[model samples]
Target: MGEFDLIARYFTRPVRRAALGVGDDCALLSVTPGMQLAVSSDMLVEGRHFFADVDPAHLGHKALAVNLSDLAACGARPLAFTLALALPRVDAPWLQAFADGLLRLADAHQCELVGGDTTQGPLNLCVTVFGEVPTGQALLRSGARVGDDIYVSGTPGEARLALDALRGRLALPPAALQQLRPRLEQPTPRVALGLALRGVASSAIDVSDGLLGDLGHILKASGVGACVDATVATNLLAASAQQAVATADFGAQTLMQCALAGGDDYELVFTAPPAQQAAVQAAAQASGTRATRIGRVEPAPGLRVVDGQGQPVAQHFASFDHFA
Candidate 1:
């Protein structure tokens, strides 16, 4: 169908949170009183971000999920979002599935679809999400301090493991691949954990890049260092990854690679002083998401990794960089 028909058929909806929504040239948003707005935008292009054969519904979920992941990092409550999609051609089935997935997650988070544009071009989905956090309570990457404990919610690295398997770079059993595929295709954005950590977490960020790389953002922002006990890398592996290494030699090293450098795990990495350890755990329990203490923020200005035996392990893994 035509552009307006395409948008109306798949995307237009009544706004619950927006002051003005889809039909207008610009949607208006109002943040809760005593709260500040948090906004983030992300773009996903075919091939670079996802394979052409990926499920369209999941693609719709991810397109918005990644952006919501940003709001999660800021400990904000999602309010609304705008979607700008580029299409190679009009396919009703694909659009329907995509809209279903996107709207489902939006509804789950109470995030309304506000306004956006559609164009005939290569497949690309851009979403700008809006959220809000109480004044002076927003978690930031710059708040980490020495002696604070570093924690990650849920798990990390399974997505990269699945990607490697799908790319033929690694050979995994069909069952293992099947188990890991969803981690790569559909990621969970940790909203409740973020909201729970608001005043408890000294610093926070979501692990979109590899753990080290994304954690590095907090370190740099806070002008501190981190000492990660490599023993915890074992805990960061998803069940699928753990199973993949069960009988394999050099499993420890393999698991560490996935944990340290594998990106696309949308879990949260956060820090809090020693005193807040209990509160952090309480937040995790309240959110029903797992949280693990893997390291400590240090006074130094660089990152260091150490094995369980207290021996230092050199780290050189880099995170994903689209242009790099």
Candidate 2:
């Protein structure tokens, strides 16, 4: 099939939230009176981001989901998105499945697909998502303050566990691997949690790059230090991963590395003041997601990991870096 034919057959759709949709040269969006537009872009290349044999449908879901996570970090409600897709060759079945997955998630959040480009090249998907937040209520990395309680939404590091198992670096039972695969392949973007945290969270960021690295962004931006309870953070792994961890004999250090630095977790890592702890929990409940308090912002200027007894743990975990 030709480019335009492929786009029309798979991606064309009516606009619900956008002024102009797929066929147009540009998508037009109107912001609410007191809200500001929030925009983020994410790119996924075949081998770097996903396995060669991954499901096309899951790839579609993930391409957009990662971009949505950025909006979630800013406490924005997803409105619309534009996709720029590149394909090595036209496969009708693959395109159909991909479009189905991408549009399904878009429909769930009322995010419309706007305008984009399709080209002949190695498989790649780039999505630029648009959202909106109250003019001054958008959560930012610079807003965290000393004494703020550091909270993480949902289970972090589960994706990393899935990654290790898939890469053969860790061995796991088939059942355990099956249970953990979704966490890696199809992550749930915590959009509701972000919306609920608008005024409650002092500073917020989605944990895309391992917990420490992403949280480090908030710390550096806010000019504060943090003491993360390693025990508490490590215990946040999902049950399946915990089971896999037990069987792998990967030792405490490897476990800590995955739990603390495993990237690709789209969960939110945010901060709120001690007084807002109740509110934060309320928000978590209201959003139908779990939020755990794992640490506290401190006057010191670097991230420190400590054991449950308040004794420091000597270890370093680095997050994903494209250049490094």
Candidate 3:
């Protein structure tokens, strides 16, 4: 099929939330009064972001999901998104499945697909998502303060565990791999939790590039240090995955590494003051997402990981950096 035909057949739809959708040169969006536009873009290249044989549907869900994660971190509600896709060749089944997954998630969050471009090239998907939050109410990395309790939403590290298993860096049973695959392939963007955190979280960020690394952005911006309880953080791994790791002969340190440095989690690692601790839990409960307190912000400046006994754990875990 031709370019326009491909787009119409797969990606095009009647946009309920956008001013103008496909067939326009530019999509128009109207921001609510007293609200600011929150925009984020994410790109996924075939080999770098996903395996060659990955399900197209999952790819579609993730392409937009990652960008939504950015909005979630900012405490914005997703409004719409534009997709730019490059394909090596037109594969009807692949496009159909991809569009299905992409639009499904979009519909779930009331995020409309408004406009985009399709081109000939290696398979690549880029999504630019738009969201809105009340002026001056958007969560930011610079808002963290000393004594703020560090919290993370949902489970982290399962995605990295899945990746390690797939890459042969670690051994896991087939059942374990099957169970963990969804964590890596299809991450749920914490939009509700973010919305709930509007005035609750002091500083917020999505845990895309490992928990520690993403949390570091908040630390640097807020000019504060943190002491994470390693035991708490490591135990944040889902129970099944923890059992799998143990069965595979990996120890607590390895689990700590995965839980701390595992990227692609797409969960939120945020901060809130001690006084707001009750409010934070209320937010979590309202959103029906589990939020765990793993650490606290300190007046000093760097990230410190400590064991249950308050003894420091010696280790270095780096987050993902495209250029580094």
Candidate 4:
């Protein structure tokens, strides 16, 4: 199939939320009068983002999901997205599965696929997602303040554990691999949880790179320090990471590294004032996602990890950097 044929056959859909969808020179979006548009774009290259042999369906899901994660960080409800795809060849089955995966999540979030371009080139997928937040209510990393409680939605180390297993850096039991494969291939974006956190969370960020790394963005933006409870790190690992330590004999510290420094969790790391702790819990329960309290914002000016004994731990780990 050709470029236009590929788009029309696989991506084109009737207009739903957008004023104009596919086939138009530009997608016209009508932002709610009292809402501000929150937009983010993420690009997934074949090797950097996923393996060349990765399933196209999973790729499709992740291509858009990552962008949605950004909106989630800002406590925005997804509205629509544009997909720019570069493909070496048009494979019908591949395209069909990819579209199914992409549209499934889009439909779930009520996010529309509006318009994009498809061209022949190296395998690359870029998605620009637009969402809406109530005026003056969008969550910002700069909103964090001293004495805010730190929380993270769901587990963050599973995807990293899967990647480590695939790379032979760690060993996983058969059962563990089965459970972790999906976390690595297809991440669930926390859109509902983000929406639920609109007022409850003082500052929010999606855990795309690593918890500390991404949380650092909030700290730097807010100009506030944070104290991470090292003891809480182990409790946040997924069963896969736990199993890696359980049956594979990996050290507890190793699992902590996975939870703290490894990325690809796509969960939310947010902060709320101590007074809003109960509300944060309520939001997590409403969203059907588990939010774990892991740390607290401090009056100091730098990030620090504190041991169970309340002593500062000396360590360093960098998050995923594209050019690193």
RMSD of each: 1.5, 1.4, 1.3, 1.4
| TM-score result, candidate 3 | 0.97
Count steric clashes of candidate 4: 0
Q: Per-residue alpha-carbon lDDT of model 3 for 15-99, expressed as tens digits?
A: 7877788988998888899999999999999889999899989999999999999999999999999999989999999999999
Window of ten residues with lowest summed lDDT in model 3: 238-247
lDDT of 2 at 193: 94
Candidate 3 clashing pairs, residues 3+ apart or interchain: none
Ranking by lDDT: 3, 2, 4, 1
Q: Count clashing pairs, candidate 3.
A: 0
Clashing residue pairs in candidate 1 (N, C-alpha, C atoms within 3 angstroms): none
Model 2, 6-105: lDDT tens digits are 9899988877777778886676788889999999999999889999899989999999899999999999999999999999999999989999989899
Q: What TM-score against the true fold does each predicted structure earn?
A: 0.96, 0.97, 0.97, 0.97
Estimate the overall C-alpha local distance difference test score of candidate 2.
Answer: 0.89
- Candidate 4, residues 1-324, lDDT tens digits: the string is 778888889999889999999997999999999999999999999888999998888988998899999999999999999999998988899889999999998999999999999989999999999999999999999999899999998888888888988888887887777778898889999999999999899999999899999999999999999999866766667454665445666677777788888799999999998899889989999999999898999999988998778898666757889999
Model 3 CA lDDT for position 20:
84
Candidates in order have lDDT scores of 0.88, 0.89, 0.91, 0.89
User: Model 4 misses residue 268 by how many Å?
Assistant: 0.7
- Flag the better candidate by lDDT, 1 or 4: 4
- Pairs with backbone N, CA or C atoms under 3 Å apart (clashes), candidate 2: none
What does the lDDT come to for candidate 4?
A: 0.89
Residue by residue across 52-103, what tens digits does model 1's lDDT show? 9999999999988899989998999999999999999999999999999999
Better of 1 and 3 by TM-score: 3
Provide the lowest-lDDT 10-residue window in model 1. Answer: 242-251
